[model samples]
Target chain A: METINYQNFRIEAENICVDYNGKVALYDANLRLKPGQICGLVGMNGAGKTTFFNALTGFVNISKGKIRINGESLRSAQKDQTIAYVPQNEGIDSQFPISVWDVVMMGRYGSMNIFRCPRESDVQAVKDAIERVDLTDHLSTPIGNLSGGQRKRTFLARAIAQRASILLLDEPFSGVDIRTEKLISELFIQFKKEGKTILLSTHDMIHVREFCDLVLLINKTVVAYGETSEVFTPENITTTFGGISPDFLFGPES
Target chain B: MELFSFLNLDTFITDPLTHDFMRKALLMSSLVAAVCGFLSSYLTLKGWALMGDAVSHSVMPGVVVAYALGLPFSLGAFIFGVGSVALIGFIKQKSRVKEDTVIGLVFTGFFALGIVLVSKIKSNIDLHSILFGSPLGISLSDVKQTIFISLLVVILLSIFRKDLMLYCFDPRHAKTVGINVFFLHYLLLTCLSLAAVVGLQSVGIILVVAMLITPGATAYLLTDKFDNMTVISVLSAIISSLIGIYVSFWLDLETGGSIVLAQTFIFLFAFLFAPRYGIFKLQKLFAGYK
Candidate 1:
């Protein structure tokens, strides 16, 4: 509950490669992120954005290189519960009878000893997370009953409840409304000020230019990585998405 | 009036209670319902309803082979049920066949083989009883075995209930939290196998799938909370089983079939009358407005 010291938290992945059934899905990739920064992972579909997130979370094997978080290996970070992840929202069953409160409480399960009951602090944290997402009214409602935007916020609340120094979110804004997008943007700013390093994948270049401190453009490999202004460009967008249609690249920033 | 006469206390309840075999049948059926009902919630939540059916049917070959080898039928059924799951996982992973198609193929193939083996071997294992449970014929040892297996299932379920719920609800999140997804996966399957084998005697293989699915699903319609769902499911199963055994006695019907129907009837009641999720409630509200 104390104020977090953000300076020492960093994510460093060097020469990470991933192969699925002998097919090279991701090539040598290097990434370095400092605490208190919101980094946007930009790529087209099948551009390995999800794969990169999976690698950082230790969900998939990185065949060729190492990833370290806060000077520890990715595996160590995972074991110590230093990293929290919000996976892509497609596969979750909406009809599942879990409540919003229960979903947020799940965040504590990672850090708590397996057999131990949640402490008062853990319960308070879950309550705080749900309130932050403005889902206090829907605390006991089945998650399936929530609107798409509310559901998205529920997952964000879960990640926040995790209290991890580093957060990895995959496509958090997809299918959300403008108000939800604004709420997420504000939350990211608050998280950054609190010294949490956050990396999120998005197809919206406008959002990246507006909110991200750093941008990493990747297409099965690291194409560019630097300050958002420098990394996000027409040429970089063209290279990542190909020349099929440059309208999304050239569209005015929203 | 004649239909209601079957419920006469002296003729139905007292007469059946006087017989030891009927009492055992009632107890065994209730145990099967309690165990299978509890598991049905997880199976339905995970969208593994067909997988439950697949595993139940796939155990046929294993049961037949176990009989031929003079081994315990439950052991054989458990092995084959787990093997079928692994095979389905393999085929789903290895080939282009989608999971449902693969499940259909594997369960049918295993079932056919079981049928062939049952015909070829000279054994005391009644094919009819194996297909449709013989409640009246269950021995004392069978009763003891069912009790043991049901207790084990209940204990294991309680110990791992939280982790298993997390696993079934959101597996990827469970993995990130360092919950061994692999362990939870196999553990649930093992429990399912055990439940299937135990229920196979009371409901037979075909109806065991229903026992594994109906109670949980019926409870699902009644409550949004999982803990409540479990309690409701167990209660429903026991109630239905008791009713089923009594109904079977009066009508001289298959005990397993009667139990399954009782559970189904309960499900229909829940489906129509449940407060928030019921069809009849919604219809009544609409009709009131009209």
Candidate 2:
């Protein structure tokens, strides 16, 4: 394997390929994301958006190629707690007996001792994260009792509390209320200003266009990736989604 | 009225403790119940109730083998309990069979092997006592073993409470935070096996599942916090053990059956009358509409 300098980018993936039991899920995918950029990962259902996110987070093994987070290998970066991943809500068991406070506190577990007893700093970080998400009123409430938007905010707050340089959010907009969407949009801008690299996968084109400075289109591999103005075009959408009506791209008036 | 006779204060509480065997039975059963109850919270949280049942049943063969070899029963039982879990995982991964089906298949097969072994051997190990338990017949060594295993489980669980809870709640998140989720998974399974071995000695194989499930399930209905759930579960189990031991002595019933039955009754009571999540409470909240 040839070595590439990763110092210029916060996240760099070079020709990464992933296969599941002999079937290719992602192939020859390459991406480089600098700090202070919000990248929207756009793809159709089962088109490998999630697969790419999983690869970036080291949740799934890449059969070939390399991934560097902040110029460090994935394992070392993970050890340093450099990445915070907020997965889709479908994977969580909401009926679990956990509180909003408890969920957010988990983000600080990486920094705590083996016993996981939270210190003063950890508690303050969790409180700040929850207040940022506007969930201070529901801190002690069981997660199961929260509404859909509030639940989404709870997980977002967890990612916030993690204090990682890279935030990977999978489908953050789905099943969330308009207020949650607005809050998340605002949070993304703030994160960008803080020089954090944010990559989020979403099916909502309007959200992608509104919140992301860069866009990545995938259909089993990287189809197009660049400035949202130049790459998230109808032609690229057609190429990535395979002949979808143009009206859906820009809404009914288009 | 006949049943109420056993509830007399002397027979129910005072006289039972006067006998040495009754006192030992109470101690042994209470210790076993406390640990099982504590672990039951995790088992229910992880949705591993069936897994508990599978491990408990699978340990039967190990107990039989231990008896045949004149070895400590817990060692053999622990081996079989963990072996069954591994076997189930293996079969589920290797074939198209669902995990529940694999669990059911493995446990039943292992249990049948144990029954066969017991039948073939001419040892003094009674199948009746093995199936339903003999709390009153517990030897001093059995008491020491139960205490040692329970303390080990409780200490280890307390130390890793947060990590194990995170692993049970969201394994993906646990991994992202650099937690060794694979090790936690095996650690939890090992604890479950140890709990099973202890339950096997006190409640026997058949009713041990109840000891390992009911306290936690009942507490789950009564509380919304894991810490409170654990405390409630342990207290309920301890109370039920005492009541069950007293009832068994006063009514001349099977000790293990009475203990499990007592736990079931508590679960039923909580299901009907719990403050927030009970069926009757919900019904009463809407009574004005009708």
Candidate 3:
């Protein structure tokens, strides 16, 4: 497999807003992510975290403001394969007949030349990704037959196979078991060591403190974003959660 | 003895090939079935069965207009087929009307206009052929035309099969991988139109929709893997087309209706008896899940 040149990938968003049929879903959402850092996006339900991710990934049209990746606009960055995203609660249709290997192979489709089949390197990368996610035994199993945790790992493996410098995950740990979360954390640590940038959303504040180097508290807009130690305070938590954080604890015990 | 002669398998299979019209009908319908089966795999997977019906019916006006202008039927069919989809998209996006309602409105309106025009034109063209197929009337030129269009559909679909499968399976993932999902959407739509036009030659509008749906549906009940489903779909179509043509010859029935009946029979068999997904097995499957 050819070596992927891991450069200093950075994403900068300014005053991003998204409107869904006249209803505002996000407003003035701004954040900057530097390479080799893990940022946790903390937000309440319906707080536009997924919408923000969608805007950043160019999946949804940004009604206002601009986002740049590695100093290039989101559109251009997307064209160059600088970012990859894993959506939350991805319930693949039960009748879909693709295997785990094929799902992971799709990550290489973007980089492959038109009319050309997947090269040896592409196959190698896919194999390594599957093995990394501990899904080597289930390589031939139909994706729809996999358990929830297995499915999430399959998608994460796809992102790994994509070889993108920047990764955006929406609620990566939602509904997954503790073992799967631990496996993912280890993988993220390994990715950070290799200089890959990651931004993920989660409600697990304890995991956020343990794994995320930076935190972005959001509720329909940017509330606070900085190093985790400075930004993940009780006051920021209350503000981000719309005053619902009074019952919550600030320390790891909560 | 005479009443039971229709059950004679030897004559049933051999008699159809004796007449030139019957031979042409068999060849034309087989080609149509092959193409439709290939397309139906994706159509059923994506739940575009209704969309197939919409495009098939909506092409009626285009067919009539093509005849009036001396243009190719496929051209008119393709135009109107794509136009209906665009109209549906427009209404669904611009207004609060749901997609199914928009589809129902656009296709029926186009079909009604076609009926009015056909009634007013006073042409010698048989309206029955346009609505319900006239396989026995297929000429050498029609054979050439059908083969050309079917070949194009086959080649393009084969080359882009993987991409199209991924597109149908998970469009969001396809988009994330930098695929032009809009292009894939229209490409699939265009394929549906082409298949409809091609099937229009042998099965007409109503039966074309059947050919676009039943073969793949039957195959779906047979396999869990899509690649297997596609192969099974094409095979089922060819087998049913041959048997339908032969049975129609034996029974002196309408060719297109017989073909659809044969397809329906196969679907029923698969529905009741398939190993993994049949109604019988579904009981056991659900019990296991419980």
Using TM-score as the measure, the top candidate is 2
Give the TM-score of each candidate. Answer: 0.93, 0.93, 0.92
Give the worst 10-residue stretch by lDDT in candidate 2 chain A. Answer: A1-10
Displacement of residue A66 (Cα, Å) in model 2 is 2.4
lDDT head-to-head 2 vs 3, winner: 2
Name the runs in model 2 displaced over 4 angstroms: A1-7, A19-23, A246-253, B1-5, B282-290
How well is each residue in A1-254 modelled by candidate 2, as lDDT tens digits? Answer: 22333346989999999987568999999999988889999888889988898888787889999999878899888777789989788869998889999999999998899999899999999999999999999999999999888999999999899888889999999999999989988998899878888999988888888989899999999999999999988888888987786576557644
Model 2, position A193: C-alpha lDDT score: 76
The candidate scoring highest on lDDT is 2
> lDDT per residue, candidate 3, A1-254, as tens digits?
33434453488899989998778999998888777889999888899988888788877889999888888877677667778887676545656877899889888888887643899999999999999999999998987688878888988999999988889988899888878888998999899987788999988888788989999989999899999999888889988888866355454442
lDDT of 1 by residue, A1-254 (tens): 55655565489899999998567889899999888989999888898998998888877889999888888876677677778888666757777888998889999997776653789989999999988888889989988788888888898899889888888988888888889888888898899888889999987766787888999989999998999888777777788886644565556544
| Maximum-DockQ candidate | 2
TM-score of chain B of each: 0.94, 0.94, 0.95
Query: Model 3 clash pairs?
Result: none
